[model samples]
Target: MNKMAKILLVALLAVVVASCGGRKKLQENPGVSAEIGDTTSGIDPEIQAYMDANGIVDSGRYNLSDPLSNKTIYFEYDSSALDPESDMIVQFHAQHLASTGGSVVLEGHADERGTREYNLALGERRGQTVQAVMSALGASNSDVVSYGEEKPVSAELWQNRRVELLY
Candidate 1:
């Protein structure tokens, strides 16, 4: 191969190897339990008892129709502050965690517009923002992971700049 082709090949190989090193860790959800909550909490008492008997706690009154509960909280370009709507959703999630004594994992992501390192830092900041809110609301066991641009909600750049909450 020519010099440029050899260099490109080596760089591609390095990315593949590095990504492989962390693939297993990402795939393993070691402490995540099975689905344990209903989408809403106003079920009949009989059904609620059945659900509780089966270890499912009601996730409480989050407005799924609300933009905030859409599960993808977006950020402005290069900014990590939660918008008012997203902030409400974070508060709801924090309340659930505080009440149930379960854990939440905030998976931070970024659009594919910036350098990988910058995107990674932005993603981490977004996750940390959620983590701070959760802690302040008494969800002490929250965790944060920055996937940066590695995980995209869509091909659209704006859609990718988000944090996904997982429990």
Candidate 2:
């Protein structure tokens, strides 16, 4: 192959390798547990395959209409600092973002142990953190949004600590 072709091939391989499933610990819910809580079931198998091949676990199209609960990227109890576990999730979206040709929203939240302002800033920081990683990975800047703590998945005050990715 020519130099250009070789470069393209290598890049593609990198993406594929980056998609491999990790060796780190993971919780396996044998089959359809709550169905709603079954995050893996929601993602398209093809997408999941691609993600797995690229080292992503929770970053693909989960039929939003199917009642699939959002994949929660947890943080330390009272902080929005992106936990190391969240990197894989962020990476999956970043790669998918390359194919979508559009923007994404990174909605941030806190786990409920902090003051509102701290939570807001924490959320934004979480959002911005995702934004930065996505940008670094492959996504464009215009594709990210940060809705800090304004929207909660549950009415109960305890459900607000989260950072949701809306693509």
Among these predictions, the greatest TM-score belongs to: 1
TM value for model 2: 0.54
Writing each residue's lDDT as its tens digit, candidate 1 over 14-87 gives: 34324333322322343432321222334434333333443544444333322123456778789999764455
lDDT of 2: 0.53
Q: Which 10 residues in a row give candidate 1 its minimum summed lDDT?
A: 32-41
C-alpha displacement of 35 in model 1, angstroms?
Answer: 13
- Please give each candidate's TM-score: 0.60, 0.54
Please give, for residues 73-100, the per-residue lDDT of candidate 2 as tens digits: 5555666565433554555556555544
Clashes of 2: 11
Query: Which candidate number has the best lDDT?
Result: 1
- Clashes per candidate, residues 3 or more apart or on different chains: 0, 11
Error of 1 at 138 (Å): 0.6
